[model samples]
Target: MARESFAIGTVRIRPGSARALELPITRLVTGADVTLPVRVVHGRDDGPTVWLDAAIHGDEVVGVDVIRQVMGSLDPKAFRGTLVAVPIVNVLGFMTGDRYLPDRRDLNRSFPGSARGSLAGRIAHLFMTEVVAKCEVGIDLHTGSDKRSNLPQVRADLDDPRTRELAEAFGAPVMLHAGIRDGSLRHAARERGAIVLVYEAGEPLRFDSYAVEAGVIGVRRVLATLGMTDEVSEPPARPSRECRSSGWVRARRTGILHLDARLGQEVADGERLGTLFDSFGKTLNAVYANRDGIVVGRTEAPLVNSGDAVVHIAS
Candidate 1:
């Protein structure tokens, strides 16, 4: 009993089967072609089409492993729908371990890209057309940029009932109602009638075990909620601690920072988060919480400049 095959690019992924292929992006100066690697899993039964993408910003490598573990755990015969996994979106940046492309454009900011545009733009257009346009639901995985680390959290436009439902189903410790950014993948996907969730955790260029575990569990819960899979045995945890508003706490002075607060800790307004010190054991300034909220993100790097984002609090 052979199952049906699904078409993506020039390949046909047979149902109840999985395959790895490279979607052509562009060729390099040395006549080598750069391509985005994709893994497609077409299930035995019909269900909603869903996409899981990671590493739009090349430095955020946590999601790359997260997607890998996800694809490994899934069995096409048991799945109910199609699963499209793009582990690395920015191929050039991933190769160089840089956050942005060589063209100095942020790949995450180039969404629904143009064919006649820049490198990032072309990649964006290719992904939107070939991957996103085929899915009804999308989850864009991410990590905190620079030296910052984020608590396991789901950020989405919760106004839409379906989006909110999926966000809550993700079962992250915290869920933030973040507005759509211009030219973001979330925005582009939503424009095409897909409910997208931006899951953020850990720090760029580093892997956090807890964050990865949470992400794996959260994505599975979403799949169960969408009826795309029946393997989620454990029910999703209680509703995520919701935050409608959030803001960053900036450094008052440029110095070396000794952080006191940690991710997922509750801080009162005006509470001392950390202290900045000069080289001579002198206190340059003490950073305080500007709002009473949970610490959703914080800087892991010691060096800082004046007005640099030090902590992110969400209420």
Candidate 2:
């Protein structure tokens, strides 16, 4: 079978191969060119086109490792369609070891952006035009923000059947039925009739081996589910659970926090999740769960202020 070709501006890509395309930039740094690196691998046969992107927040590098491992293991000859992998979308943020761009915009929150807007907006617009429009499905990878940690999980609106299926096939440790945020990649992809899954794991600026392995295997499972690759007879084990909703547990008073529970641990209503203590080791207050659920995320830093979110419980 003859392979199809992809043309994005002056860059031309042939099917059943991989290459890194440089996206032109103008706004992030004056006179400095920023490139959005993409790896396109199209199979020789017919199947669904899937886009796997990671590191939208530069510091969340777990997805980057996952994508790299998946890309390396895939055989184009065995694939049925195209797999576009963008390992690092926020080049500026990744370079500076930060989550947000130099302009202080959250790349994840700047989706379906404008070409004439800010740096993040333009990059988002470029991705929407060059990649999202050409793919049938997508998986956007992410992790917890600074000083926070998340268990391996998939966040999607389970109301959408396709999204639900992808989330399940991704095989994360948990699936959170999250609402779609405005200007998010998932929202933009859904608006364009493409089902996109958001996989969250580990923490920013650090790589968890378990999270990376899970993400890599999850991508492979999704590809197999989509008929892009053959299914493995024995896939890796996943430790995920489903949750209907999740919310943050905030600190009631300013003090140092000592967590009594860890991520993935179940908590009961009114159970002590943590304790706040004064500088002199005097107990100030005890933090309890208002509802029974699983601890999916929490702040790692011990310092806390009144109303600071210390933990996230999902039910």
TM-score, each model?
A: 0.97, 0.95
Alpha-carbon RMSD to native, per candidate = 1.3, 1.6
Which tens-of-lDDT digit does each residue in 171-280 have in candidate 1? Answer: 99999999989899998998999999999999999889988989999999999899988757766566799999999999989999999999999999999999999988
Candidate 1, superposed: residue stretches over 4 Å from native: 1-4
At residue 214, candidate 2 shows an lDDT of: 81
lDDT (Cα atoms) of all candidates against the true structure? 0.93, 0.86
